[model samples]
Target: MTTTAPAPAEAPASRVMAVPPAPAADAAAYFAARLAFHTDVADVHAALAAGAGDFAVVDSRSTGAWDQGRVPGAVHLPTAQIPRLARQFLDPAVPVVVYCWGPGCDGATRAALALARLGYRVKEMLGGIEYWIREGYAVETADGTRQLPPDPLTAPVGTDDCGC
Candidate 1:
């Protein structure tokens, strides 16, 4: 006997399409600009794994959060300290990528704005440390470093890439 997959359930009419997508050229430009302003956790992990040194990753959360966990090599520069200590802690020549607690927190955005205003090129890391942890990347803590198994909801298990 042969079996076939069931048909997918019909989706509700989307409020998303209520406003039609922008024209292709406009969409391309918008998306490109967005990429310039944001970097995702996966891309950041790949860059770090490759030992790329062109940019700096910054954790913009507080001291307690830093103690809890952080990207392995991220600089512990809380958003409030970006003004006084940014130039001292970071090289002006390097591009900066900032991440905060998670999608719900705007600390990274505030840090990015502070860095940009100080004449440094910066992008906010989308999804922040929350996504970083959720993706099963190794995190550094006061105790040491540890990596969790990939969270199936956020990342592919037993695969090299997400195929996005």
Candidate 2:
């Protein structure tokens, strides 16, 4: 009766599998594919100053707002009416830049989307008209608006940076 008790069953080997964490989605990539282009107010002004190709600049604000003041050569096409008038005023092949009241407004985005839906190459101008004014660019007004004389702080005299 000296038989030793059977050795305790060996515990199953613990499996240490290394599972990698899931990759995060790229926010820019996801949105970039959906949007046509992105341009800041300064870029748009530069493009205009450089005499870039016949791109259309559309002010997406209402008539009253546009009447108050707007980009010198911008065409008025309110966001609400873009779906109906986009193809009529915009060329499908030409690049179009859309802007609203200012950075706080999303009207430009809405207008851009509407133009894009109609097959127009469109970009929403970041900062909108407010930036345009703050940057010292000329704007058209009912009383014959004038561009603020170039100032050294704003831009060097006799330079294109004044956006005259």
Backbone clash tally (model 1): 0
Task: Give the clashing residue pairs of candidate 2, or none.
Answer: none
TM-score of each candidate structure, all chains considered together:
0.90, 0.68
lDDT of each: 0.94, 0.80
lDDT of 1 by residue, 1-164 (tens): 99999999988779988789999999999999999999999999999999999999999999999999999999999999999999999999999999998899989999999999999999999999999988999999989998888889999999859998
**Cα miss at 112, model 2 (Å)?**
0.8
Top lDDT prediction, candidate number: 1
After superposing candidate 1 on the true structure, give the runs of residues whose Cα lies further than 4 Å from its correct spot.
1-14
The C-alpha RMSD of each candidate to the native structure, in angstroms, is: 7.7, 11.5
Model 1 Cα displacement at 63 (Å)?
0.5
Any idea what lDDT model 2 has?
A: 0.80
